[model samples]
Target: MAIPTPGQPVRGSRSGAPIMALFDLLGRRWGMGILWHLSQGPCSFRELQQRCETISPTILNRRLKELREALFIERCDKGYCLTPLGSDLQKLLVPLGAFSRTWAEVLPHEEASS
Candidate 1:
């Protein structure tokens, strides 16, 4: 794949706002975790918080609301779940997970003395 030349924009992107916009939205607090949690199935906010394990309720609520507005997530009888686009985003996270596992495996760790 060719890298975008310096000072030149990539195809179809004007100033990279579109891509940055997605990250700006999702890079906030629980945004990515919310997407990850919803991948299993629809769930309520409480459950979502539990799964994330670290997100504060306030932050989680904010991210979920933002995602819902972006049409990446939805709320229903199930409480919260990914919208169709959100489902697609879930598929995208798979490779990142694999990369993380591979990276952890190659890193050095402390040895326990016998």
Candidate 2:
């Protein structure tokens, strides 16, 4: 799949609003997980795979390529690290993380349907 671009149609928006495009990219499997982990520090492919426990190598490679193309991450000698833009995004998400914790506390837990 091609990386979601601002002007091109994304998953939910036909007009492809920038925010929608961002959501489309980050909503993919392991997309947000990769960025969140990389925010901690640089990690090589093997290290990142370990951090993201269940992510298959194929999906990790694809997400890395897409993130790099989007200027959110870059490969350095150390390994894959977040770019300034990605760091900025991570900062923005911090508050959302806090809110999620609180929200989780309030929400009723769902039992498994089985």
lDDT of each: 0.76, 0.92
Would you list the clashing residue pairs of candidate 1? Answer: none
- Candidate 1: stretches off by over 4 Å: 1-16, 110-114
Q: What tens-digit string does per-residue lDDT give for candidate 1 at 50-83?
A: 8998889987877776777778888889898888
Give the best candidate by TM-score.
2
Residue-level error in angstroms, candidate 2, position 21: 0.7
Residue 71 displacement in candidate 1 (angstroms): 0.5
Query: Which pairs clash (backbone N, Cα, C closer than 3 Å) in model 2?
Result: none
**Candidate 2 global TM-score:** 0.91
Model 2: residues with Cα > 4 Å off, grouped in runs: 110-114
**Candidate 2: C-alpha RMSD after superposition:** 2.3
